[model samples]
Target: MDIKNLSLNPNYNILVTGGAGFIGSNLCEAILKNGNSVRCLDNYATGKPENIAPLLENPSFEFIEGDIRNAEDCLKACKGMDYVLHQAALGSVPRSINDPFTSNEVNVSGFLNMLIAARDAGVKRFVYAASSSTYGDSKNMPKVEDIIGKPLSPYAITKYVNELYADVFAKTYGMETIGLRYFNVFGRKQDPNGAYAAVIPKFVMHLMKHESPTINGDGSFSRDFTYIDNVIEMNVRSITGKNPDAVNTVYNVAYGERTSLNELVELLKEYLGEYDSKISNVEIVYGPERKGDVPHSLASIDKAKSLLGYSPSYDIKRGLKQAVDWYWKNLQ
Candidate 1:
């Protein structure tokens, strides 16, 4: 389905927490592109102002530099907002493993702050970024939303807690909440310099620099890498769709396909090499499996299709090509 076909209330004012991060910034851009007013709240802890630098020029987009953990900030951001897209959180399994407390503070306590603030502000809907990591330790392929395994890391626990809270809020306060369990999302503007940088951008950066990319495991572990445009579509559908059954439900945002790490490296090398032939020779180095990481992840998009009419626009190979092109143009 085309995103422009989705009927949204033009007068609605939206609040996007963590609106300066990769996914959040993209959501902000999409919201503004649809002719809606937006209020963005970000602490800039991991989110950079440069990500939203272009949006600042638009009078419809207003940004408040604030932390989600602060109740006052969340309340202020949520005021007069019709929809709340809470994307602010500390991600990465290794980072959570190193300091679970900080992850809990940002992901758990901060999430609660946003929920309460949004509910109190009388917002129409609350949508937050839930992780595919919430399906931890489950050996199931194409994981469905109803079934999930025990959380393996602090990050997983934090995201799973979001679903739990969303459910309770729906039942108790009559507030509607939707959780989008995003699988390995990658695209332009995804940070490549950080220690906690995601695999796609990190590999793209290495391949561009003619450096060997490291595979975390024996290169067999796989993931259902999702593109940012598909994610943005899901957000738009969740907020604008008229289905009552779709509200307060969690859907897996993915391409319903999996690619191994080794295959992924080859794809990146092939794409980036188009810009520089030498990058084709960039070798891959295998390392030990990361701690607190799941062996595999693949999402079932059937639920999203049946409920939210989520038709992903791009698959892995197509998405990687677009992402590589963007990084090559912008990062170079």
Candidate 2:
């Protein structure tokens, strides 16, 4: 990240909730590289310790091992921070379907806790992770931020409530907040070993092992599989943006293109095959469509482009190659 190009101050203090997780840890690394002070708050519930282990060596990075569910932890994490990047949330649709209580407790209540803490700490801006699932059951291709449909799952409800709370907080308390609705963000450091692991990383790991990965529906289900660098750029831009119009609203952080599961698998095989030719012959299995899963997800990134000047450098093919390389070197 070019601090000068982004117009970011090198001395700003930033707090990243869930800093031990995939997205948050990546944010910490980028911010620290830009010469900013970073404090991370995470309980390691879903966050992995290995993701953040290397960051501990950095003098500018601080990790607070605490849960967002605890108000005191949230308060401590928010104090003395210029901006808050709240990325802490329980993040699986299937997991939420099986365990709504835990999902609500963390995604919704914990999110509220972070908001109150940031408000009290007088943080300049609070940028949080919203979800594409918030556009539930809406058949609109290239989903615009303003035209959201009803939520399809409990996890979706929590993320949607975040936008609502952010708006209300801005109006009532005069807080500067921005919500980024990420669409299927995947890249290095994303876990592929969980029951609710995201498709990209999970499939990558399986393909590396020469195992068949199951696609939920007929290979037609598609997603706007965003890269992690793009997501990191959005978080940084949200904090530093000078536009008042961009401060209070939500923007879709995506590549603005959709890739079907079949295309995604083929791309993964093609990329990984460069390392191991045998991977090219791996078969993909089909199964029942996932409950609460959308048929297609494609975002219109015009709002992010116009508002924050977000220009995503890596599309799926470009980003997937990097991701595959990382997994091959690290996980294999």
TM-score of 1: 0.98
Report the C-alpha lDDT of model 1 over 126-199, residue by residue, as the tens digit.
99999999999888777989899999999999999989999999999999999999999999889998889999
Error of 2 at 120 (Å): 0.6
Model 2 RMSD in angstroms: 0.9
Residue pairs with backbone overlap in model 2: none
Clashes of each: 0, 0
Query: CA lDDT, every prediction?
Result: 0.92, 0.93
Which candidate has the highest lDDT of all?
A: 2
